[model samples]
Target chain A: MPTIVVDVMPKAELLDPQGKAVTGALNRLSSSRESGSGISEVRIGKRFELTVEGPVTEELRERVREIAADILSNSVIEDVVNIDFGDDAS
Target chain B: MTFRIGVVTFPGSLDERDAQRAIRLAGAEAVELWHGEHDLKGVDAIVLPGGFSYGDYLRAGAIAAVSPIMSEVIDAAGTGMPVLGICNGFQMLVEAHLLPGGLIRNAHQQFIRRDQGLRVENADTAWTNEFATGDEIIIPLKNGDGGYIADAETLKRVEGEGRVAFRYTGLNPNGSLNDIAGLTNERGNVVGLMPHPEHAVEAGFGPDTEVAMRSGVDGLRFFTSALRALAAV
Candidate 1:
């Protein structure tokens, strides 16, 4: 079985309010949870790393992209598919 | 004896320098440690600073958790050496199974930068010995993979044992359950927090204060606390 890997980011174009909310939340939770702390989770975009085994070809790459956009990544708010691998997909 | 702190330099680690500076500010000798190197050079404590190790290529610090140097770091931590991991470093500590839980991406999907606050809940850990039981402090925070996730049992045990060090006060940044900001092992030797305390060490460069941002250097206490713990032994 041929193996391929794909990495993605939160399409730079979309605004990620979740990131903002969390950053702020980390600070609050830090103190609120405590009888005193308020540090929150650091802000960062979403990403996924997937490994699939099949034909390592351009056609397969395109098919994977379609699946990601349709299901894995929401194109309406998130930009998906910044990488590919099948012949030059690295 | 003067404390020797080793700062690991994993490929793509952005905050190692800041950690090193924090070490020096705390009166400890800072040692540069390579992620690929297996030898630890006998440092008293180790720090895994934040940043994209291997460009977050394989699950944020996933690949890095298995680096050669971890063998020593893990062994040391097991033997009660002070091991502190920042943002990416905290991710690595989890991936290595040194600590519990996992770090996921921000649910919002954006890179966030802010002056964050944290309460010192467990001041008994080696890295936090200098802090009071209820002290609150602010530090700079930035990252893209900061969500902290764990099962209910683990969270309960952590609370029972007082392993939950710092907690988020006002908000829940990454949907982390129980609002945990930092944690320590049962022995209280290892610590992993999401904020960058090192960045808040020097005045005019750290977090903002009521009078002026970054004018206070309370964050330096983290490093000093670690050194103090090792010395007490």
Candidate 2:
């Protein structure tokens, strides 16, 4: 079995308020520490892991890419990255 | 012949009945359509009302975009059938690639409900022909993920072609680029907007009007415009 993983996130140019809010929360938590706001940026996104029985062929890879680009990610506001297949799949 | 307007009701849909009623108020026959149904009931036009479709899972309107009924909607829109997407329905349209751009969470990151003012930017569309290009109207707007975004080139193209159907007047409710509130396809049939026009179609029940004791029934123009478009055909 081969496991395919896809990660989607908002585009770099777009404002990600959700991610910003999380980063703000992180800053508030670390304000008392000596670390002193070590984090600079944070981005939130979605990941999908798919396991398919049998071998991972080139055709299957292409099909997964197509679906990832067309359905999993919206080109207008989000980008699809971290598309990889795990070799250790049972 | 009475124009048959189909109002699609998906799971979690909250405004399909309101859209149907608006269509009826416009003197058109309101037809109820289901998302799981493959047929559109031979409707002359279609309205995808707003709500948190699929519980806003994965993304708003992402699941409903590929639902069974959407295939028929895409086909009908391609053939110039009038299709209007409101709020969450607008999200589904963008997800389905029937309209340009995508809607994301508001800049303020909170659900907002208000009487929004909009200016008619393009009146030649099937859904906006009843208004003059510069006419300003008020309608109810309520949503969380209503901020609209698109690439520079695409925005320029839509703006250049006068495909921008409506623009938020006075204030940008959700930080939409260029104050855009609604858009139409190249053929002027498919339209999508973040506001709930169906909510403003009836008097007394709609938003308050500035004219004192009047209802914000400006949204009636959208449905009436659809009928006018059909009449010209």
Each prediction's number of clashing residue pairs: 41, 0
lDDT by residue for model 1 (B105-197), tens: 775666778887788999999999999988988877788877676666777788898988898777767656677888888899989988888
**Per-residue lDDT of A56-77 in model 2, one digit per residue for the tens?**
8878888988989888888889
User: Model 1: DockQ against the native?
Assistant: 0.09
Top DockQ prediction, candidate number: 2
- Model 2, B31-100: lDDT tens digits are 9999999999899999999999899987899999999999999999999999999999999999998889
* Residue A37's lDDT in candidate 1: 38
TM-score per prediction, in order, is 0.74, 0.95
Stretches > 4 Å off in candidate 1 = A1-90
Q: Distance (Å) between predicted and true CA of B46, model 2?
A: 0.5
